[model samples]
Target: MKVDYIIVGLGLAGLAFSRELEKENKSFIVFENKSQHSSKVAGGMYNPIILKRFTPVWDAENQLKIAIPFYKNMELLLGNKYDYKVDVYRLFTSIEEQNNWFAACDNPTLSSYMVPKVITDKFNGIDALFGYGKVTHTGRIDTNKLIEDYHFYLEKSNKILYQDFEYNRIDFNENKIQYKNIETSKIVFCEGFGIKKNPFFKELPMQEAKGELITIHAPELDIDFVLKSSVFIMPLGNQLFKVGATFNWKDKTSIPSKEGKEELLTKLKSILNVPFEVVEHVAGIRPTVKDRRPLVGLHKEYKNIALLNGLGTRGVMIAPTVAKELYNHIENDMLLRNEISIKRFENN
Candidate 1:
């Protein structure tokens, strides 16, 4: 089979790149073994602010500028509503934090997303003693539904192969990539944490952080917007909230641990005063890097192979932008920015 490209792995990065190919009428086949669960089990929030430090995310404005319309277009194409425009309410722990939020709101870039007013409105079952700061233009993408539906669409079109892509099987000397009977001009690896197993690209540093989330059915908690305190509790409709996530650096396994659940429960108690039932607990490893920027660009040795990974905790917001940059860089011979490009690690 002859195709323009063979994309390995079908997480957010893979899907975004596939969409770019489809837009340009490029034919490609995707190989996926469902090894990565980061995108599937992600919190899926596209907040522009770094909630931890009350600052804007890296390239937040441009990322959301492309991401919102990008996903909205996908919703139209896939016929599913995945984007939810939910405001994020940051629970203030102290008066200092509240002042900091107000100060962040004055930033020329952050002024758009951060609310100037501290919301004094009390929410039931939420222990916000110092009020909350509501952020605008922030929301959640039902990435689980988006991925599931997109896979169905790919399967229907016969564009996806449900199997492993062995690195040793690829023949790179033929001017084109050859894997068994298939031949392609290039290959893009969106393998998430699974990229560690890839021989050609495994030398790149990848710090996989295992994260866990719990779903709770809290009928009495009546807040529609996302509440961020000790942890973020997002509404999932029908009185269900998705609470998460604990970062464990040592655990490479995706299996939910007893320690993870207990950690979430402990944090959950600090934020909630209402009765709730734990519905589910899930875990996945996030493809993180030390510098926290995504890993993008072609391999130094293999020009035809590209990587899109290390989206970290902000995959929903970063994936679309990086995917476009990678696609443009590969297809149009465009110059890549130094920060996200894999070449930035050349000295190391």
Candidate 2:
């Protein structure tokens, strides 16, 4: 079987790239090893606000503009409802922090989302902090639904190969790449943290981290928006909420651990005043890079080979724009941004 592009990994990056290729009416095939991974387990929150310092996220405006439309178009194309643009209520922690936020609201960047007064009595079951403010233009994608729909779409199109991609099976040539008995003009690796084994791009700075999340049935918590303090509490419908996740930079394993569970339970006890039942637990490694940016470009020595990984923890927000940019660079003679290009580490 021959195709214009062969994408490895069926995560957000791979799916986003495939969607772009489909838009351009190009041919491609995708491969996936696992049935579920990081993308499926993600809460899919696209927030413009960074809660730590209460600052705006990187390239928030451009990324949001590109992502919202892309996901909406994908929803239309798939004939399914998946993406939703909603407002986020950021619950304040302390009086000092609340004052700081109100003061910062005058800044040009935050004026659109910040409110003057704090909200005190909107929620139930927990002692109110200073107050809560809203972050406008926040949205979320139904990642599991999107992945399932795309998988079915790929199967219907006969463009997916389900198997573990062994590194040794791939044979690289000057103008093409081959794996097993299949060959393609170009091969793009979107293997997420699995890229650590790719001989061509292993030298790239990858700060792989494992994240764990737990699901609980909290009937008393009727909040519709995401709540954050030490850990985020995101509603998952049916009186269920997802409270997670612990970030372990040292351990990159995908296996769920007892320590993670205990830590989450401790955090949950501190935030919630209602009765809940523990339901599910999940763990996955994020393909984070050192500079906290995606790595997208052709191999320095291999022209027909490219990489589209390192989306980090923000894969939900970053994948669409990066995939579009990568598609253009691959199909056209365009150059990738120097900050994200693999060329940055060529001499290292």
Candidate 3:
């Protein structure tokens, strides 16, 4: 069979790219192994603030404007509710942090997202002595729901192959690619950390990190907004909260380690002054980069092979715009920005 593109992996990256192809009425097929947990088990929150330093994330406004409507349109396509507009309450660890919030609020770049007034009373069973900063225009996409429903949509259209893609099987020609019985004009890899196994693109630097999250039944800590401190306690409704996540750079395996769970509990307990029972624990490798920018663009030698990855911890905010960028680069011969283009690492 012949198609315009063959996408590997159906995580946020692949889904976002597929949407672009759908918009352009391009013929494509996607291969997903369902092995990566980063998207399905993600906290799925998209906030403009770094929270660690009370500064806006890079290109926050542009990404938000593109991602919000992109996912909302998906809601219309799938007839499932996954997009949510919720406020994020960032707890102040010290009085100095409170002052920093005010300083950030005064900055022109952050004024639009930073709530001027500090919220001292948003939820009970939480320790917020210095008060909290309310982040506006922030929310989450039920990533699990989005993945499952989007995959179903693709399957309904006969556009998905539910299997692990073997890189060795692909035969690259001058202007096309072939895999098994399939032929395509181009192939895009959105494999997340799994890209490490792809011989063609493994040379790119991928500073991956393992992250773990825990789900707990904390009836006493019922809240509407996401609570942020050392760890994020996001309400998943039904008296359940998804508190996570512990970042470990050493371990790259997907297995949920005991050390990770204990670390998360320690951090969660630091801010949440409520008792909770652990219900589940999940882990995945974030396909992060050294520069903390996304990895996008075509391979230097193989023009038909491309990549859309390195979304790191902010995949929900970064994927849509980056996907659009990749699509334009391929279909319109548009040059990718230096920071995000894979060519940045060509010498290394």
Candidate 4:
């Protein structure tokens, strides 16, 4: 079959690009093998402020401006409650940390999201001696729900093929590429950790980090906002909280390990004083880059082959903006930014 494009993967990156294609009335088919876990098992939190160093995320404002409306429109189409607006409270451990919190609020970029005052209110299960710093305009998108519903939509529309896409099978014609029986003008690889298997773009510098999260049933810990300490505690409703994310550079696999679970529980116990049981444990490899920028652009040798990946830990926030950039770069002949463009690694 002939099509405008063939998207290999259905994660956040692939989904965002598909929307871009749909907006332009472009015909495309997506191939999926369910090999990636990062998008499916993501924490799905979209916080502009990087709590680790209390700095503004790179292009946070612009990303949110496009992302918020993008997901809202998806909800209207799919008729599912996926985007949730939740507040994030960064718990302070020491007086010095509290001072840093207030100091960060003075940043012009950070001032919009950072609340100057420390939240001194008591929480039942959390131990906050120095209070918490609240960050506004933050929320979580249920990525799992979004993926499932979107796949259903794609299936209903007969736009997605549920199978592994073999790169070696691709036959480049004069203007189009043929993969098995299908021919397309372009093929964009949105593969997450699966990019390693891609011969065309696998040589690009990519550092994969395996992250694990646990869902706990904490009935006593009543909190409305997402709590960030050593680990993040995100409220998942029905007396459940999704706490994550241990970044392991050593472990490349997506299987949840005992060591990973122990590490989370140890950190969880330090900040939380309530009794809780682990209901679910999941692991996924985040497609991270050394420079912490997304991988977007077409292959240097093959113009029709493109990529959208390495979104790191903030895939939910970065996907829509980068996808739009990639689409415009390819279709409109617009130049890609040097940082995210694959040209940066061509010299390597």
The all-Cα superposition gives candidate 3 an RMSD in Å to the true structure of: 1.1
What tens digits encode model 4's per-residue C-alpha lDDT throughout 11-100? 999999999999999999999999888999999999999998899999899999999999998999999998999999999988998899
lDDT per residue as tens, model 3, 1-348? 999999999999999999999999999999999778899888999999899998889988999999999999999999999888888988887888888989999999899989987788856678678888999899989999999999999999899999999999989887889899999999999999999888888878888889999999988985899988888988888998898888898998999999999999888888778789999999998999988999999988888999999999999999999999999999999989999999899887
Clashing pairs in model 2? none
Please, what are the lDDT tens digits per residue for candidate 1 over residues 1-348? 999999999999999999999999999999999888999999899998888889888998999999999999999999999999999999888989988988898899999888888798977898677899989899999999999999999999899999999999988965688889898999999999999999977888888799999999999998999988778999999999999999999999999999999999999998899999999999999999889999999988888888998898889999999999999999999988899999999788
Q: Which ten-residue region of model 1 has the weakest summed lDDT? A: 170-179
Whole-structure CA lDDT of model 1: 0.92
Candidates in order have lDDT scores of 0.92, 0.84, 0.91, 0.94
Ranking by TM-score: 4, 1, 3, 2
TM-score quality measure for candidate 4: 0.99
User: lDDT score of model 3?
Assistant: 0.91
- Model 2 ranges with Cα > 4 A deviation: none
Best by TM-score: 4
The residue-by-residue lDDT of candidate 2 on 27-48, one tens digit each, is 8888888833888888788887
RMSD of each: 0.9, 1.5, 1.1, 0.6
Return the candidate ranking by lDDT, descending.
4, 1, 3, 2
Please give the TM-score that candidate 3 achieves against the real structure. 0.98
